[model samples]
Target: MNYYDGSFGGMHLIWWILWFFFIAWIFFIPADIPYQKSKKESPLDILKKRFAQGEISKEEFNEAKTIINSAT
Candidate 1:
């Protein structure tokens, strides 16, 4: 109610813009961050684990490993 003075006091447009983005980040950032992360195992790494665990013989492992390497 102090319009005679140039006092928007605590409510400026820039502050509103900043608060909009800050509140948006509080709600949206964490879930979006997990999707942005590379949480997948590489083909070579998976293959090595399989070989180590005796899921595949050395010959099969080497063949699959070669194919994985060449494709990348």
Candidate 2:
């Protein structure tokens, strides 16, 4: 039982490196995957998008904007 053996310390260091790599991969790499849930758009943001796309008219956008602003 030679505690001074470098192989034991080397293996322990390798295990730590492996664990750190695994956790970093799990947390930092999956955000851009297409199946991940995206943040929900705010109501005002949706309204603005619709107005820009011509799905809603200026009057409708203004009314919705007013309502959303007042509610918040």
lDDT of each: 0.86, 0.89
lDDT (10s digit) by residue, model 2, range 1-72: 766855558778999999999999888886576687889999988999999999998999999999999999
- When summed lDDT is taken over every stretch of 10 residues in candidate 2, the lowest stretch is 1-10
Error of 1 at 24 (Å): 17
List candidate 2 segments past 4 Å from native.
1-37
Among these predictions, the greatest lDDT belongs to: 2
Error of 2 at 40 (Å): 1.9
* Every model's TM-score: 0.48, 0.48
Prediction 1 TM-score vs. true:
0.48
Prediction RMSDs, each to the true structure: 5.7, 7.2
Q: Residue pairs in steric clash, candidate 2?
A: none
